[model samples]
Target: MSRVCELTGKGPITGNNVSHANNRTRRRFLPNLNDVTLMSETLGRTVKLRISAAALRTVDHRGGLDGFMAKARESELSARALKIKKEIEKSLTAA
Candidate 1:
């Protein structure tokens, strides 16, 4: 899979690496991503996602996966995460 954060939609960024001799080279800054499996209480299942370390911390700070998704903006989420968010919302409404 691509080096992207599934929840935060963060991807590699291109930049120049400068040297002491005033030389520049192309370089990529990749996000700190981790493959994690978080449980969804409402859905009664565990969801696997590739997310940034910052996002994982945010999820924990927000109380859990569900809390984070509930407060997260749709535009900031990946397509897969958006789908999961929808399912989470549906489950919340159903319960």
Candidate 2:
């Protein structure tokens, strides 16, 4: 699987590891990702996604999967997430 956050679109970032001797070596700073299953209130089901810690916290702050998805941008979402977002929107609007 790719090292990317499905919810927030956070990916690996390149940086340098500097030694005490002033030697710099290239390194990757990857986002702290986790596999989580979030429940969608609108869809009334659980959905699993690979998301970053920050994104997981944001999901809580935003009030859950449905709320976060409502404000989430289309470009940042993966194919699976985008499909879930669409389902949420359709259900919400139909309700």
Candidate 3:
């Protein structure tokens, strides 16, 4: 997908790159994103998402991502995995 964090909604930023001659070129600052499968407790399934490294770190630091997902899966019969699956399908259709 795009160079964006789906969880945090972070995307590439525009900036300028300067040369020795003071000439400027367009530059893009992209977030560090990774495709990961997070367990969903509410749905008893896994949720795959493109998240930024920072977001992942935050989840890891909180020690609640997994637990929250599990709870979500258990609570939601139509789980987040299904949503992800649909979203992927929609993307595929557009492509």
Residue pairs clashing, model 2:
none
Task: Give the lDDT ranking, best first.
Answer: 2, 1, 3
Error of 3 at 70 (Å): 12
Model 1, 1-95: lDDT tens per residue? 89988888889999999999989999999999999998887778999999999999999999888999999999989898899999999989988
Q: Which stretches of candidate 2 lie over 4 Å from their true place?
A: none
- Which stretches in model 3 have alpha-carbon errors above 4 Å? 66-95
Give candidate 2's error at residue 39 in angstroms.
0.4
Write one digit per residue (lDDT tens) for candidate 3, span 5-85: 655566899999999999999999988889898764434566677777887776676564543333333322233434554
Highest TM-score among the candidates is held by which one? 2
TM-score of 3: 0.61
Residue 62's lDDT in candidate 3: 54
Which of the predicted structures, 1 or 3, would earn the higher TM-score when compared with the native? 1
Error of 1 at 73 (Å): 1.2
Off-target runs (Cα >4 Å) in candidate 1 are none
CA lDDT scores, all candidates in order: 0.92, 0.96, 0.61
lDDT of 2 by residue, 1-95 (tens): 99999988999999999999999999999999999999998898999999999999999999999999999999999999999999999998899
Query: Whole-model lDDT for model 3 versus the true structure?
Result: 0.61
lDDT for model 1, on a 0 to 1 scale? 0.92
